[model samples]
Target: MTVDQLPPAPAGSPPPARPGAGRTLIRGLGQLLITAGVVVLLFVVYEIWVTDLFGAQKQAAATEEVDEAWAAAAQTQAPQTDTVVVTDPAQLVTDPRERTPTYQTLTGQGFAKISIPAFGADYQFTIVEGTSDDDLYVGPGHYPESQMPGEQGNFAVAGHRVSKGSPFNDLGLLNSCDSVIIETQDDWFVYRVLPMPEEIPTWSSTAPTRPLCADVSVLPSPYEQTVGREITLPSDYAQILPVPGISDATVPADAQRLITLTTCHPQFSAAERMIVHGVLTKSYAKAPGFLPPEMGEA
Candidate 1:
């Protein structure tokens, strides 16, 4: 048939392009891209919001379990009160090996409660026994190799910053001398954040900046490298050492009792880690209706 005489495409049908398939292919690709974008959006929402809900529920349940355990023990043991008169904030523990409140070693179980005054009165979480994914899915997870709370070594903890309730989301907000209180079945141990490296040279001279920070002078030289807040890579395990930054197990006979907190740095990313170091400053024996004065500090 002559070119102009060729039969026309059926009325209302799409005109041919190349082989009558180019338009269909473009439309299919566009639909696929739109669907992929929607999927990505939903995934982000789940990670940011839905995971938080799940974390909250898990934390609540863990807290309840710890409360019950503490209550059961109270029936058998007497409450420890303000018996020890604290004269020096630097020397709260008399014996280096004297550990208070023996801890259980079960993973994924809540054994301790942590409260940060800087994070507000409502800022508290039950610390799980292990740093495994399942354990932290509930709340802050304790490193199994670390020493127990109130011991003469580093008691390190790990938590999520952007998901699973984001317990340490505001860790960066903590300042020197801020209190990080840990509640055991028998007593409350308060650890104050160490001075930032910049504040160290003048820490003693500027005690008034955060009066409590002056107490950090008790820490040995090994801790000089440790700061109130630090950004480090995930591979840096020395941050949790017996004496932070000291890789060996040989802890000083008078090693200071310390607390270390770790979380993903910069939010929503795990490329680096955020480390916070604190030294034991004051400890209070728990009595019925008793509250540590540090808990109310700003």
Candidate 2:
């Protein structure tokens, strides 16, 4: 059995691992991580961009419905006898329960238009009737229990700060004295953001930064403790009362015609709430093709 037929070598341990095997495993892991990142990015895009498109469509449709309703009502509306000429806008609402005449609205119904001049002349959204997520998906939604626009109570509204049209995305940009205009079937109401508590102490030390708040009244007593712009938890229901921070049953007769806007704070996070309060400073009767001068303010 010379070298002509060499005995078969016995099977031994598996071949030593390849030098590039570790690198190959790392590359595969990197690919997996990249894919996961892309998926997460897509989800964010859908939430921020895709949802905005849908929200814009809903807002447009709601705006059209509001326009049509106003036009139709104008043609068929009979003259009202109870209409009282308001010589002073501050005297607009002596009673919190008294509201300007408006057509009845259902949940998710569009009843008004809100424009923040600080945002831009073109920035406007139809104000809907309820605060449900479904209602806010269209635009800023009114708290059903709160007073209507220009009423003597809080005209509370809520909107998404990051998505779904993001009507209130720049709420942080609005400081004291900025105007928030609301239009109804027959009237246009202008509300000026109130001064923050810090500013209120020095509000009179110098001339007001803007003329809107020059004659503005400060939040009284209990409300004085509340800031014009506040960060709070979602459970603060008193923020929407007739007189903010005051009990509904104990709302003073002189309760202000205030407007409160709420949105998620810190943008893209719902861990807290941001609120902005305003007071009605002026009101105008709606006329054909006439917009209030405040609408152009920034």
Considering every candidate listed, which one attains the maximal TM-score? 1
For candidate 1, write residues 1-298 as lDDT tens digits: 1222336789898765553466567667777888999999999899889999999999999999999988888866755554554543344333324546654657998989999988988889999999989999999999988988888889999999888888999999998889999998877888998888788787767876655665666355766677888999999999999888878766677788899999998787789999999988777666566778787885
Clashing residue pairs, backbone N/CA/C < 3 A, model 2: none
| Residue 216 in candidate 2, Cα distance off native in Å | 1.4
Per-candidate alpha-carbon RMSD to the true structure? 6.3, 8.9
My TM-score estimates for the predictions, one after another, are: 0.85, 0.81
- In TM-score terms, candidate 2 sits at 0.81
| Clash numbers, per candidate | 0, 0
> In lDDT terms, how accurate is model 2?
0.81
Please list the residue runs of candidate 2 whose C-alpha ends up more than 4 Å from where it truly belongs after superposition: 1-33, 78-99, 249-251
Give the deviation of candidate 1 from the true structure as CA RMSD: 6.3
